[model samples]
Target chain A: MRKNNLKGWLYLLPAMLFLGAFMVYPLIDVFVYSFEEGYNFASQTYFDIGFYNFSYVLHDTYFLQALKNTFLMVVITVPVSTGIALLISVGLSAVKPLRNLFQTIYFLPYVTNTLAVGLVFMILFKKTAYSDGLVNLLIHWFGGASVDFIEGPYWAKMFVMCFYIIWVVMPFKILLLTSAIASVDRNYYNAARVDGTSAFRIFRKITLPMISPTIFYLVITGFIGAFKEYSDAVALFGTDLNAAGMNTIVGYVYDMLYGDSGGYPSYASAAAIILFVIVLTITCINLLISRKLTRGFS
Target chain B: MNTSSQTNYEQISKTSARQKRAVHVLVYTGLALWAVMVLFPFYWMLLTSVKSYSAYNGERFPRFYTLSPTLQNYADAFTTVPLGRYLLNTLIFTAATTALMMLVIILAAFAFARLKFKGRNAVFTLFLSLMMIPNELVVITNFATITNLSLRNTFTGLILPSVTSVFYIYLLKENFAQVPDTLYYAAKVDGTSDLKYLFKVMAPICKPTLVTIGILKIIECWNAYVWPRLITDDENYYLVSNGIQEIRENGFGRENIPAMMAAVVVISVPLLALFLLFRDKIMTGVSRSGTKG
Candidate 1:
């Protein structure tokens, strides 16, 4: 047993060292840095230490904007995208012909580069001197005024952001849910039909309950994913996200560290800690809700 | 009375069949519409990439189909910016990171899954808990550490922090544990080394899971943006993700939309091809991770 223990640790050594340097140490360092007041990056010095960094980050307008944007994104995108994906998955479960073709089409966005997709979306939505863009042209055809989805009003930009997020994320949810629905026992549905149960009621009572666990799983993961949405915003609005009024919490940390308003390590660490807290609190709440919901279904 | 009841049964069956047909049509229509919404962007991308710069700019309203197709933008994508270099850099990063991560995770998973060790479960639990710390927190200090080490703009810096994934290690451990212990014992009794047993027996048994992890890791490294963007400001070190962004901002400029789209198409095609070829493996990997989480 002693010899085996030594051998086991030898196997784990490389991974342990890498994780110690990159993951564990950074976590501790970030936590400590968050409390250091007005730390200088170049000098590697700080005069004082307290919650002052936290206070500054919490009060900063850019951080506030980032917080608001992240919250709205979380609130809007999570439920809307999951619902849309569920509908599509359920529809997909019922279809027979060309199902594989449709599934393949839906999954395309999952593998494509986010920035590349963002550029395509930018071209599709941005109104330029030469054209009104395809989306605005469509609006014009429908007798609605052209709305500049990119570089436009707050609501319009938010709409575009949420729409883009939904489009990108729905494929995975659809894949998972479609399989979840397919795995459900066929006997229950047949019994329900024999008793003359309506399709809607059958869905509500049987199908929903059977797949409730997967639904709850999607919601929890969706919330977490949306909270950490920096790249998507960067892809859409460029790296100067604060100026675009669409910066996420993660983006705020990056900006503080390495943007036009850069070189504020203390402030960045504090903002990162705040993001960590928010995500943790929400995850806890989601876990609680899912526990109750799943138990109720069972 | 029997005849009347039979006729009634026939009438009911006919109505139900018609209703089922209606539902099928509705489902297909809905799926088709959503599919279009899902696919239209790719269509638009391919369309815009082929249109001439002059033709693209001259349009008063965007045309869904281009009358004259040109490969000029693709040529421009390569020449105007070193997109070929970005692709090469991305390939190097993805291959190095995935290969190194696979080796590290496999060894660690073998330890946890098969080896008898003091504090093994406790250590595995600790590793699992590390996943709870969001990547954002870790990334901040990693940036500082990489900079302090003066390893910026090098492949070593780009590949180091990404070479160990706790989630993948956990996944592989579960898979490794599923192999029957008899084979392991038989090999051990024959005086085969642990390393040899791992390569010869354990790995081949878990080949599908291994492939899935490799494919997923490649996709991740290819799509990685934030860390690469932070670490490498030098154009020579940029991955396709950030390289394309650089092209958009500086190389191509915003005015050259067709050229920009062409750049994007070049970057997106490789992974698209990979996914198409290994569709089942990727889907199973994704769905497995989703449910297990």
Candidate 2:
């Protein structure tokens, strides 16, 4: 038994060493740095330890803007994308012929590179000396005036951001929900049909309840993923996200550490901790609600 | 009276069949519309990629199809920037990271799943909790650590932080546990070493899960942006994720839209092909991860 223990530790040693250096230590280092006011990266020293870094980060307008953007992204993208995905999935479930083809087409975006996709989106929406972009052209065709979705009004940019996010994220949600809807017992639907229930009522009473767990799961994960969005904005708006006013919370942390106004580890750490807390709180609340709901059902 | 009731039943059946057909039409129409919406950007990308730059810019309105498609932009995508080099770098990063991660995770999973070590469950729990720590928090300090080590612009720096994934370890452990214990006892009776038994028995049994993990990890490493972006400012080490951005900002300015689209098309094709090829495995892996949450 003792020899077995030794062998186990030996096998685990490589992973443990890497995790300790990268994951575990970084977390502790971030916590310590967040509280260390006026820490200098060059000298590796700090004047004092306090909550001043947190206060400074919270008070900063750029950080606040980033907070607002991230919150809006989470609020807007999660429900809208999930609902759209659910509709698509339910539609997908009902159809028989050509189902695999449609599923494959929908899942394409999931595998595409984010930056590459962002560039495609940029060209599609961006206005230039050449012409109004494709989207604007579509608007004009529909007898609506052109709106510059990129490099335009704040609302327009936000609209484009939300649309792009929904476009990129919905594929995975659709894939999941399609499978979830498929896994639902056909007997429930048959019984509902025998009772002469309307389609909407059958969906409401049987389909929705059957798939609530998956929906809850998607919502929670969506919130977490949206909160950590940085590269998506970087891809769309460029690396200088603050100038574009579309910076996310993760982007803020990167900017604090390495952007034009960078070299402030303390501030970055503080902002990171704030993000951590927000994500953790939301996840816990969702978990509690899911537990209650599942318990009620079962 | 019986004939009248039979006629009434036939009428009800015909009406219900008509309703079902209408529902099917509605469903198919809706799915097709959404599929077009999902696919339009890719279509647009391919269309723009083949159009001549002057032709792309000269249009008063963007056309859905190009009459005289040229592969010139594809050539320029490789030449104008070192997109070829970026692709090579990405290939190297993905290969190394995935290979290293598989080794680390497989061993750790083996230890957790089969070994009777003291405090094994406790250690496993600690590893699982590591997943709760938001990656952004860890990334900040990792940047500092890599810089402090002066390992910037090296593959080692880019690959080190990504070589282990707790989630993959947990997944593989669950898979490994499903292999029956009788096999191990039989192997022991044959005087097989634990390492040999693992390689000979457990690994073959869990090949599907292993393949899924490998493919997913490759996709992840291919798409990784933030860490590589942070650790390597030198253009030599840029992955395709950041390479595409560099091409936009510097190599080809905003004026060269078609060339930019060409670059994007080249970068997106590999993974799209991979997903199409392994659609089932990828779908099952992703769905499994989601539900486990």
Q: For residue A268, what is the lDDT in candidate 1?
A: 91
Root-mean-square deviation per candidate: 2.7, 2.8
Error of 1 at B103 (Å): 0.5
Query: What are the models' TM-scores?
Result: 0.97, 0.96
Per residue, candidate 2 scores C-alpha lDDT tens digits across B1-293 of: 37875576556556678788999998988888988988888999999999998999888788889889999999999988899999999999999999999999999999999988998999999999997777888988899999999999999999999999999999999999999999999999999999999888999999999999999888888888988888889999999998998887888776888999999999999999999889999988987775221
> What are the runs in model 2 whose C-alpha is more than 4 Å off?
A292-298, B1-15, B291-293
lDDT of 2 by residue, A73-96 (tens): 899999999999999999888778
Candidate 1: the clashing residue pairs are none
- Please provide TM-scores computed only on chain A for all of the candidate models, following their numbering: 0.98, 0.97
| Per-candidate local distance difference test | 0.90, 0.89
Residue-pair clash count for candidate 2: 0
Best by DockQ: 1
lDDT for B220 in candidate 2 is 86
